[model samples]
Target: MPDLDPPKRSRWTLWLVLLVCAAPVVASYFSFYVLDLRGRAYGDLIQPTRDLPASLALTDLKGAPVAAVSLHGQWLLTYVPDRACDEGCERMLFMQRQLREMLGKDRDRLDKLVLVPDDVNLTPAQIDALTAHGAPATVLRAPRAAIEGWLMAAPGHRMGEHLFLVDPMGRWMLRTPATPEPSAVKKDLERLMRANAGWDKPGR
Candidate 1:
């Protein structure tokens, strides 16, 4: 009779693969919840973290296709902007950029994302503003409904009024107040960086 058992080395390889895939999720949970770090987080810690939806579709300003899953592998400082791109939008953009800068050496591990929820035509100046300061942000357009389904805004406020933070694993884990204090947001970013240092590194 032929042996049905798998090789011991093959079993070890499978277990190793599973551990590698689950490390980030485990680290995040232990750092934020079990350690009571949630109490210290400036941004509201989302219970039952929401994973990035595979069905979410996105496109660039020029209408080129962009995959939503492509955003995984970096901490995301996300802002959902209106088609108009008014004063509030500009302020949020500035704040998001500055918060990443405040990360100091860990900056590259974080990416700034401006998700436009409409098809409004952006003037050259608007595009320049988004890419200003040498550190360009990834600006993409997705359907308003898709954005609404992914990011949660504070009660009595629209999604554009707040900033959302997503983990490298593509999970939506933090949501700031409608008008977040930059200093407070910075502290939260720093804490997360330190907590995940063992598993996360700069670049993808």
Candidate 2:
């Protein structure tokens, strides 16, 4: 019988390659989670981080399908609000845009997202306003239940009240209070950008 040694060696090699590719992400997360981040991080860290759900269905205003996994590769600063673009929702969108802009050169490393729940549609004017700023946010419609399942709100608080942060690896990790101060949130964004600077890069 022919020797099977070469095939087994090739299999082991493949496993090694995968492990090597995953090392940087694993190491960075370990450092962030295991280290003394409690006193350092501004946003509340999610204990046992949640991965973005595969079932998260998203669609553009035109009704085109968007893969949930496609959302990976860039840090996401996300907000979920009702279909109506009320004064409060507009205020949050403004703040979210400001937060991303404040990142300076690192701005591209993060993307702003607004998840509209209940499959409701946005009016033409609302879409225009959302896309007005030079750096427009990616607004997509998602199921209300799906958003609730993936992101948790504080006790007695609605999910829309808090802003969420998802890492490049697709992990929903950090969250801010309902009325988040831009300055304070900016600090947290800076800290996160600094921490993952090594492995994370700009763009999706």
Candidate 1's C-alpha lDDT?
0.84
lDDT of 2 by residue, 1-204 (tens): 876599898999999999998888887777776663667776789988899998898888777989999999999999988557677777888888888989999999999988998655667787897888788889888889898899988788877677999988788999997778889899888777766777888897
Candidate 2 lDDT trough over 10 residues, lowest sum: 33-42
Clashing pairs in 2: none
Residue range 141-173, candidate 1, lDDT tens digits: 888888889887988987878899998879998
Best by lDDT: 1
Clash count of each predicted structure: 0, 0
lDDT of each: 0.84, 0.84
| TM of each candidate vs. truth | 0.90, 0.90
